[model samples]
Target: EADTCIADTAVVEVVPLDMTVADSTVVECDSVAEVVVEPVDFSLVDSVEVVEAVDNPSEIRLNWDDVNYIERNTSLGGILDVIVLGDNTEYVGYIIRNNPVSGIRFKTLDNKVHMLKWDDIVIYSRRPLDPEKSILSQSPLISTYTFAGLKPLEGLIVEQDYETGLITIETADGSVQRNSARITNITNRPNENLYTPKRKTTKRRAVY
Candidate 1:
């Protein structure tokens, strides 16, 4: 009777069940996506090289003493690598041949020619004249020479070749002169007006 009473007092509970599906992706063998991941080079990120300073050929540093040094040494037809003091204008040129005119014919590094005779055209340089380039030595004067006790033709000498002893004289501007095969004393002009006049006796001889 106690077991029946316990069974009648026990209550039965029923539970309802429901089913749900999670969404999924469908993959086909032929349509499978390929994700290609290339290997990254970590060394490239830190491979930057240090840049070095380069020197400029045209731009130079110079002082007043350096300029004074150049001014003291620069001469006719002297080749110098230089720059203007205040303006820093650079040039590779010469003082040029002593122009019959007063100016300097400065053949520039660029081949453009100029004259440095302007009183305002100030310049500076540290380099000396090149001994090998552009004849810098003073040439021998042909007029100062004598041929066998004969003086040179007056005001006629222009240039002379020291190697061959050949002499050149200024003739017509564009004409060539033919020289005689031999130079002789026959060409020498006689010295005129060499005699002095005698003064007449001004006083009697001591009154005897």
Candidate 2:
């Protein structure tokens, strides 16, 4: 036989078991219960801070060493202008290696590979090529006035060695080298000096 219990208006069947029910209680409801939920504050949560983006994130400012490192790794090579410290012989070619033991190796325009010791090189310059500047254009005859009582060499400047303070000029006869310290001034064109002195002006005094 089965027993019956009333849960509000619905009848619930109670099955007989080998267990005893003590202090049994029942509550009656007439309607569906409504839940009241309190709103949670999200202001206490930590937010991620955003940084200002740069215009060029991947763009790099490369130094001479950085350029060498990149070129060594890429093996593509780049143009280099170098001068020998002893003989002052100028060479222009594509630098291929940065060897410490064998020295710097480069390929010349004539398809010749040459290696020179770092100590043997005085001027090692690498710059971006400008299409506007060319040797084919007519250059002014530069005359370098020397502090020493010597005849000034008038020709086109081939290169200016800042490290050794020497200027190489190309003349009709051959290349000539001059010490920058010995030269006082360089005149490119007559009446149009390369460097001009500032004009002195008299200051007016206020009457007391």
lDDT of each: 0.36, 0.51
Looking at model 1, the pairs that clash are: none
On a 0 to 100 scale, what is the lDDT of residue 97 in model 1?
A: 39
For model 2, the superposed segments whose C-alpha errors exceed 4 Å read 1-80, 131-208
Q: Report the C-alpha lDDT of model 1 over 40-89, residue by residue, as the tens digit.
A: 32221323444333322235666534443132223433335443423445
Model 2: per-residue lDDT, tens digit, 20-127? 232333445564333222333333323444445432234455554445332343222222344455577766666667765556776766778787776776765542
Per model, state how many residue pairs clash: 0, 0
Candidate 2 TM-score, true structure as reference: 0.29
Candidate 1 wrong stretches, greater than 4 Å: 1-86, 98-102, 126-208
lDDT of 2 at 55: 29
